[model samples]
Target: MFHLLLVIIYLAFISLGLPDGLLGAAWPSMYQEFQVPVSYAGIISMIIAGGTIVSSLQSDRLTLRFGPGRVTAVSVAMTAAALFGFSVTRSFLPLCFWAVPYGLGAGSVDAALNNYVALHYASRHMSWLHCMWGVGASAGPYIMGYVLSGGGIWNTGYRCIGLLQIALTAILFLSLPLWRDRPGNGRDSATRQEEGGGAGDPAPAVPLSLMQIIAIPGAREVMVTFFCYCALEQTAGLWAASYLALHEGVSTEAAAFFASLFFIGITAGRAASGFLTLRFNDTQMIRLGLALILAGILIFFLPLGGNAALAGLIIIGLGCAPVYPCVIHSTPALFGADRSQAIIGVQMASAYVGTCLMPPLFGLLANHISISLFPFYLFVILVLMFLMHERLLKKTRR
Candidate 1:
């Protein structure tokens, strides 16, 4: 039953990722059909991000009240409905409306699942579960591409993913019993253990407010570290192709293809990191990842030719693979398991904040200054992330 539960969680993660790449892939067709400017996509994206931030901030409350299993099932259903809404929407306004539930569902499920796995699973499983997310993210674009290539509309692509999410939602609902049957099913039990109470000595689960969570030692540092890490990752992913084309003088088509190497590296690297976690702990894995990111950035900084730049992107992606999962996996240890859910929820919100803000900020710089500043921008964020992570380790040290 535990193994079956794990399988369901993995599928949930995949479902969580499926819609993430859909808008980016289908935006071109979507904009034209709706008679909106390409820039309108950003508006829709911002709406989604805003909704996600709100829901992520509420995740701890919801998860505590309903349990992760129920939260997961409901969240996936919400996302499925949002996707189906996207499939039938003809105007840009309805798309924006659908983005609300889309983001809300995404944020809740992401926080709930990450916290649940961090509490119940090994570091290796955390890494591999995220690898599953990367797989889904990668597949989303391909599925959309296939539909477009086959003369099917972008709506059909959305409908396909929506159907998949509905199926996963059903599985999740059926697996609620598994979640309940697991030991430490409720926050009260988990909090009791964290408080050093034996199973026989029941204790209340005191909820941590956002202010209380932030007041915890190492909490602010870890949150900032998450912000920096996500900022670097999203900025790099968003602008890599443009940087290659504009600054490195790669052809448009080639640059686009090369940019994909970043995500490919992340997916493959997470798979490898799952195995590596057996030997190295989370802190060591994080350090190694940070070092590789630094190295990758330096390579990008040098005039080592276009091929070297491509290699740097791949290396950067590889570096990114371990950092996110390791950070999440370490949350229960760094903070207490009792506080992990609230902390992880805030971390997810912080990550989305970075994702929503940084790329566009870099776009501004690239427009006014130079796209050549891309590597420098990444370096700045990476250095901050490294320093904060080290500080977090020191503060949390027993």
Candidate 2:
């Protein structure tokens, strides 16, 4: 029963990650079809981020009332509806508008699922669960690049995705009955009490006075480190394709495929990290990851080096792959598993801020400068993340 439930959750997470890959593939078509610029294409990311922020903020309440499985169904349904909306969008404004609900749905699912898995599942499974997301994300775009047929009639493409989402959502909903029922599994103590629970369960500790969580040796570093890591990552995944398509003379289909390369790297890296955790501590893995990312980001921009740069992007993918999920798996141990969601939720909300800021910032940057220059910002963001991670880990050890 446990293994079956774990597999279902894994599949659900993979489905959730599919949009990351698929969205990039659709960008060029939307631009050509709508007669919009690359900057406008970037707005789609902002809109999605905005939706994530709203849903994340509300996630505690939703999970409190309906349980993770129910919330998961609603979020997945919202994602399907939004994907369908993207398919049928008549104009740019309509498409931009749909992102709100899409983000809401995605954010809800992200918070609920991460929290549920953390509170209930083992640390090892946490890495694998997110790996599923990476696998799904990698598949979403590669399929589109092959199947999109010159990026015309994007509806045909998106409708297929919508069908996929609907199918995935149905599976998730049917499996909803399998998720365990528990109150405050991932929230802070007070929040848990409001949701109803007894003292008998091995509750995650919470302080009565400060209201904010105190860090364990390594957790604070992990949280802040991930905040920067995810922010940088979300920026790259969401904007890299638009940057290429808008300015690099790459077709949307091709640019989307390039974007998928990053996720593919991430998928491989994350899946590897799932097992690697058995062999390495978070700090050692992170240091190695940071080194690769630094090298990879530079190689990605090397002059007269397309193939090398592509290889670098893959390395970047491998480097970026583990940090977020590693931090996630580690968070529960750092913060009591019970309060893992609320603490991580706050950190993830910060990540949403990065997602919100980067798209429009890059969009406006691309408006004035060039899309090539836009990626420079991501590079800088990554360096900052690495430094922050180093600092956070130092703090953790003490």
Q: What TM-score would you give candidate 2 relative to the actual structure?
A: 0.77
lDDT of each: 0.90, 0.71
lDDT of 1 by residue, 324-355 (tens): 99999999888877788899999999999999
CA error at residue 92 for candidate 2, angstroms: 3.1
Residue pairs with clashing backbones, model 2: 51-103, 217-396
lDDT of 2 by residue, 147-190 (tens): 67664466766677678889878987787657663454445443
In candidate 1, position 372 carries an lDDT of: 93
- Judged by TM-score, which candidate is best? 1
TM-score of each: 0.95, 0.77
Could you tell me the lDDT of residue 70 within candidate 2?
Answer: 79
Candidate 2 runs further than 4 Å off: 35-38, 143-147, 150-152, 181-224, 234-260, 297-311, 359-380, 390-398
- Give the Cα error of residue 388 in candidate 1, in Å: 0.6
Candidate 1 colliding pairs = none
